[model samples]
Target chain A: MLKDGRVFVIPCSGIGKALGTVGRAAMYEVVEKLRPNEATTICLPLLTIGDEAVLKLARNNPCISVDGCPFQCARKNIEASKGKLVASFMVTDVLRENKDLKPKAVTELDPKGLKLASILAEKLATQIDEINNNNR
Target chain B: MAIVKDKVGVVSCSGEDLPEGTISRIATRIVLEKLRPNDTVTICLPLFLAGSEDERAFARVFPTIAIDGCDKRCAEVGTKKYSGKPVATIVVSEIMQKYPYLKAKSRGKLSAKEKELALKVAEEIAAKVDEVLERKKRGDSN
Candidate 1:
């Protein structure tokens, strides 16, 4: 385990839309690429199941919720588990801003979907830094 | 309320740690979108376990097919916990056992082999959907 103070990036695994897959891809980009040391993720389903270790990790650190739809399952799960949410993103809202990016597939992202995820990942990385600055 | 006669709830676990988890998710989408578009609706597992009353209600009332990635079976467990027992459960690991060559490695993007495996799994889920729907009179679409 990397030392304490990592942000938990919770992405909604909503299978209904391509946007949710984009959110998941964006999450992987943030934790695995953009801010590897600063951010980590636990499956949202694990948090909902009250997995003790996952709950501890979530509760101990700041969380960023990336939800695909308005239902906001990721954010609500964090709140339900009493995890601190430092930032929340709606993939639909992001797509609105970057209208050129279109995610077409749910299984694996197409070129445009990967681009959208990168955009979202870059935004989350920036926010994590800003949050760190504020905390300091 | 009563179980919806026409629709089945498909709850697929989102297991991020393993590639099988990814297969479970992608396969679910294929079944919902490509294979059984009109007959199945997705029940987001995260929302379901997070005490979304509507999700719970749907699983409780509708014929639910829980698709899980690993032996842990989060989807099956969650559906059984909040709602009634799922009408059926599909585990990807078990399915993988039947065809060893269809192994998937990446969680982010699927290879062609992985896509084929996902299609096979999707077909399995679609079959289950048809079974639960009791569609003996109707012809299978794909």
Candidate 2:
């Protein structure tokens, strides 16, 4: 179980496309590998379904939503559940910034897709660090 | 029948209201990571419902299994609505009815019985994957 006061990382549960997969991959990289101690994951669907525990967690802590596309499901759901969103990242914006790194597949990421996820993860980790430092 | 070069797609409702949703998610992971690693892929239902052309296109081309948490059948309904009908559908409610002895205890985390039930569902899905792929292979041979 996630403790209180830690930054909640919400990744868009968009498993349908490459961009969504990239967003999920980057989110895991940040929460599990990069800042495991400072941040934890809140399942996005739980927020949508009105899970009180998940909603309470979002309400109490600062959240970072990583959205895969323009629909902004993660961001919208987090806010709808009354959570405080400190920052948000869009995988499309990352692709736009690095035009050459086009993802090859949706289900399984290719080298470029993995690279894109790494780049996004790095950026998200930096934001998490900033939030953690500010709170301290 | 043209041979499909890609693997089957696994779409789970991952619903939050019930432990069944958690089961669907974990069961999907079991199939993707353990049971049929190279033969299956994941399709994100949120993006598909939100109008992703890539997701729709992939679903249209590949065989898919929809693992739904409840009778709401969001994953199954969404897949059928936007793309083609799912090759296989697994509903947790039906699974519970089939095996009344196995009850999921928690929505946040699966208990031992819940994990076992989830694995049972995963094995069922794996078998479905084989069935779909085999049918496609047979079609290609004809």
Candidate 3:
């Protein structure tokens, strides 16, 4: 069974910084666990490549972009695809709020990094619920 | 005066949807941070498409090694379209043939075998970076 509301969670997945992977990990938590049915993810590269199927997903669903850095690639790509953005987040801000937690790896996150992902996921989940409620 | 060495850009596929994508990112990170930190810099694929001039300019002026998770070669394709052609492109799926035992099963968490495979891939990227930089030293066109 699937949930009622729909939103796309797009992570920048930038390999330049550790935060990129953290942001991606957080998005995974949001779509795969927290709001499984309400949110999903698409390949940002595919959308950039002008894939028709992916373009339709962006056109129809509201998007929530999570970026690891100031580049905001996911958010930019979504806008370039003409996708709608309901809300956006920065993993750095999440990290800023949790001064105690520090993420150190870009490839595979450490324990603290994983915890950071969870914290960011929880925040995104709350935003997702509000968007879902508003849409309803 | 200190001699400034040319730097190489490593562009990895965003690979948001696949386990192999996870492997590709890990391998690229190993190369950038551990193996050739001084010689290489990361070029985010999303940044290329999202209109980051600095990344595109770097790829155009310098040699780039595109690492892709699958045959789609998203990183390589994007690099070529936005900037210049990358000097080399490595696809993780092709490398998987050598490590039949490694199963990259999760995006959030990688299996031990997958971690080993990532190391193998990183070694490959590291070697390529060395090769490209050496060529630059030899006055070859990227």
Candidate 4:
């Protein structure tokens, strides 16, 4: 099992657009900064390829997928890998909610992009806390 | 160097099926995180393949280096298909051929040999970045 009863985070390994980077930045914030003890991450591509250890972890732990677009590659891969997805987030939804934050540059996010990532991270953190509380 | 305005885009086939794929990802990270942090930016392969106009647009504007793990050349082919042809391409399998002693034990974790291979590939990528930047500078000057 994962240490500290943390949730697994799967970010869409979508490198194509600013939204994809936003999803990845938000996932990093949730896993490495905001909820370091409460969340971990599995590479989405590895899960797709059926990595045994990642599959086992997914089967055992609840996961949250952060997808860049509507396709929800992270969510689909998690389901395909036999992992339980407790909650999911979409960068497009976040952008829709926060219309002011128009991120520029797919590879290098501008300041607005970082702000958007933080906002999404905070939302994800709340969802993770809710899952933990319910489990407890 | 007169403050190059654009950074090189680094796209790797972060394929999970093979150890070479893992090597490609690790090596890309080395370039992004350690080697040429300011000179290169990573473009996600999945999004690029899945029709992200933003990624395709960025590749068209910036010089891109596609790093492939295997002979399938998914990264190279995908970049060329969606965006323009990459400025340079690096295949991990070709790198492996050059350094047969370095081997990756698993797709999930990098063995010592794999780490070495990743470092070697990263250095090569860094060199490529310099070469691309040099070409760009020359083109701009001309």
Which is superior by lDDT, 2 or 3? 3
Candidate 2 has a TM-score of: 0.60
Interface DockQ of candidate 3:
0.74
Summarize candidate 4's per-residue lDDT along A10-43 as a digit string, tens digits. 7774655678768877877787689889887765
For model 1, residues B19-59, the per-residue Cα lDDT tens digits are 88889999998988789999998878877755457667877
TM-score for predicted model 1 compared with the true structure: 0.88
Model 2 interface DockQ: 0.14
Chain A TM-score, each candidate:
0.95, 0.95, 0.93, 0.95
Say which docking band candidate 3 falls in.
medium
Per-candidate RMSD, Å: 3.7, 8.0, 3.0, 9.3
Model 2, span A1-136: residue lDDT tens: 5458888777775655678768877876777689878877766665655657878889999999989878887887787778899999999999999988889665457899989999999999899899989988
Q: How accurate locally, in lDDT, is each candidate?
A: 0.84, 0.78, 0.85, 0.77
Model 3 regions lying over 4 Å from their true place: A1-5, B1-5
Ten consecutive residues with minimal summed lDDT in candidate 1 chain A? A1-10
DockQ, each predicted model: 0.53, 0.14, 0.74, 0.11
**Clash pairs (backbone) in predicted model 3:** none
DockQ of candidate 4, scored on C-alphas against the true complex (2 decimals): 0.11
Best-performing candidate as measured by DockQ: 3
In model 2, state the lDDT of residue B115.
Answer: 87
Fnat score for model 3: 0.80
